[model samples]
Target: MIIGIDLGTTNSLVAVWRDGRAEMIPNALGHHLTPSVVGLDDNGDVLVGLAARERLITHPHLTAAVFKRYMGSDRVTRLGRRDFRPEELSALVLKSLKLDAERYLGEPVEEAVITVPAYFSDAQRKATKIAGQLAGLRVERLVNEPTAAALAYGLHQSEPESRFLVFDLGGGTFDISILELFEGVMEVRASAGDNFLGGEDFTEALIDGFIDAVGRPRGLSDKAATPALYQALRKQAEQAKRALSSNQEAEMQVLHDGQTLSWQINDAAFQRLTEPLLKRLREPIERALRDARLKAIDLDQIVLAGGATRKPLVRKLVAKLFGRMPAMNINPDEVVAMGAAVMAGLKSRDESLNEVVMTDVCPYTLGVEVSEQIAPNRFQAGFFLPIIERNSVVPISREQTVNTIQDRQQALHVRVFQGESRQVKDNIFLGELTIPVPPKPAGEISVTIRFTYDVNGLLEAEMTVEDTGEKHRLVIEENPGVLTPEEIEQRLRELARLKIHPREHLPNATLLARADRLYQQTLGEERQWISSETARFQAVLETQDEERISAARQALKQLLDEVEGESWL
Candidate 1:
């Protein structure tokens, strides 16, 4: 069976095609959402989702979260006794989701469609595909997250001709996509975003405000500090930030290392703290609209997706900017996974979705670096010459020819880059290739560079020396996650050794861990009540009666739901 996965920065989810509809598959915890956290348990076994998230405060040295922002880089996160690359950490999350899917379908699932942010670079997309392979699944395709959300909304099933905008503010990344639907065809006109900006930053802003209100204590320098005050403050900031969505104010009191801090903040103060991040959101929206050559009023609908869109200020800003209320018919947090499932169905040629046709565009300009003479005796060596402009439809090729600058030039070097800058150094360096040219006088040797970007975001460059009729082909394959045959086998063996807790015990473990965390956060009678209920649930689990355990688990979750207000969900 094939399923769809949204490997988000803060949360991850899986879905599949079932009973003629897209259905989200719950994890072992009996919840559709899983916190994107990975850590090592006290017993040294791998812990993911809520279990790991709960331990993040007490075992801050061993847990890692928000690594999605480093997707294509070489950054390593240390989780207890092991250091792992971002993709490796991501693979663990994928493996957990895969296991959940297998358990839910009662089958060995092997293929999946994964979603990435629309503005993700070629390297980032490639890394995501490799993460899937490392988890022992064949990645059939990589779909853009915003486009996936659009599909989930059934924009193609609407009027024959319509224009819409998708403003996706996720946990660790933000994307703005402009799409047009015409005659059962959904075409993405443009895409833009800030990969480093999202809800996490907003939470950090609150942390900054709290620190400003109650001066930073000693021994707290970074997030990695163990037994420090920052983690507790971070958790409280997250809770208060969520509360401000409905409540006029949120109250917080935290004690660490004999230092007591208390504060009460309202919406106005929280807005002031997060105003910078809110401004960052507007840039990409304006850029996407400008690239699509449409005014805000031209859009027929504005659709919001990703968990961050639930914020009231975000919704209000979107409405005011677009002159229309954003559509919320679909749950923002689940829409991307739902759309990814639609893509999976489309991949398998599901009859119900056969009539729908979808297309995507390149998010950035791709070109070669060249030298241009700006003055009689001066030249700029890193000028960027665009072969294909940003937002161009995929599966397209463009060619440009250039002459040798010096006499008897023996070779031509073609350096590829992706960006919208006049200077090549400012852009992302993709790859390069050199072709031997027949010795010739200045301006006598001409070489043609052809850039072909496929629908899967694969870039192929061909350099044909005009005089010799010889060709040099380069398929830029420097993705950090791309593995060689030997590397793949080695990684497969390495991953095989990692163990996740058994499925039957995950729900109980997650609940107990959450209860333990609450016990740490509360005081007086509240703590006593939590302790009593946790002991009762522990006693029920000891009986090992499946039905009784399930009922108790539900009861505990409901009780916690009343106290926590479903903020985590």
Candidate 2:
């Protein structure tokens, strides 16, 4: 059976279309939400999800989290004695989710539809697909997160014709999509977002505020804050952020160097701290509305998706901006997964979904870099010539004709890029290819370059020498972020050697890791108590008695919860 996966930045979830609806699959820990964290345990076993997240504080050197922000880049995160690319880390999470889906479905699931941010670039999308490949799953489709959300909502809407906007604010990325539904078709009119802006940024804002307010006064330099202390502060900030969403005030406290640092923030203060991030959210919305050629009053509804949208502050901003309360009938955290499941069903040709048609747009302008003549015998390089404008409907092919700039030019070098900038250097270089032409004077030789963007958002460029009818295709294999077939195979072999921690031990390992992290964060009596309890639990595990071990696990978990408060979920 084909499953749907929401390969998110902070958390990931797997779902499937069963019983005529999308059903979320629980992991080994019996939870639908899995933190997107990866780490290597002391025993050299790979760990993912809660266990890995808990290690961020106690075993910071062996763990990695929030690596999704570096997707499509050359950034490498070092965990334990090895280094990993963002896609490799992501593949580990995908593998865990794939196992969960298989266990839940009672079958071997080999294919999936994964959801990504609407504004993710070509390299990002390619990297996502590569991640899926590494996980032993064929990525059937890479659906846009907002488009998937729209599909989930569109399936239930009774109205045959309506225009709505999807405001998606996840942990590490934000996206805005304007969609119109008519006659069983859901067409994304426009898509825009700040990939770096999300709920995590707000939490980071709180972190900075806490540091400025408390750490600075204590003569704590940025370098003076150790990884464990930073993790503790981040955890506290996350908790405070959630608390402020419902409560008028929240307090963040962290223990560092035998001292307790604390900061209190009210709703008003939290807003002030996150104002810059809030400001970044406006431009994307305005751009989407402008591209769709509609105003706030024209939309029938404003649908909110992604876990970050649950924030009261963000909701207030969206409501004030739109002059209407947004829709939250569905759970924000699960909406994208549900929609991804819907897309999977559609892909499999589920009878109930056969009538629905969904369409998406190219989020950015795609064009070829060109040199324009500025004067006699003088030409300026690095000008961008657009082939397909931003927000144009995708699965499209657009072409542009250009003449050779220099006399006796034998070949035209085409550098493809994606962005709104008029200068090529400012845009994202996708790939380049050289098309040979007969030597001739400037403007005597011309070539037509055509770019075809598929439903999966992959691009194919073909350049044809008009006079000779010679055509050459540009394969985007040179991007540093993308892995070639050979590289993927080699990495697959390498991943095969890394063993995952046994599923049966995950719950116990997760609890122990959490206790360890708490041990590092607490001070005085609390720290001593955690240490004793952790040892007691470890001793109990050595007994090998199922009943006694289970009881001890529960008791220790209760104590940890009491000491650490409720979990972020």
Which prediction has the highest TM-score against the true structure?
A: 2
For each candidate, what is the lDDT?
0.86, 0.90
lDDT of 1 by residue, 155-184 (tens): 998988999999999999999999999878
TM-score of 1: 0.93
lDDT of 1 at 559: 77
Clashing pairs in 1: none
After TM-score superposition, what is the CA distance of residue 84 in candidate 2 from its true location, in Å? 0.3
Candidate 2 backbone collisions, by pair: none
Clashes of 1: 0
TM-score to native of every candidate shown: 0.93, 0.98
lDDT (Cα, 0-100) at 509 in candidate 2: 97
Q: Worst lDDT window (10 residues) for model 1?
A: 219-228
RMSD of each: 2.5, 1.2
TM-score, model 2 to reference:
0.98
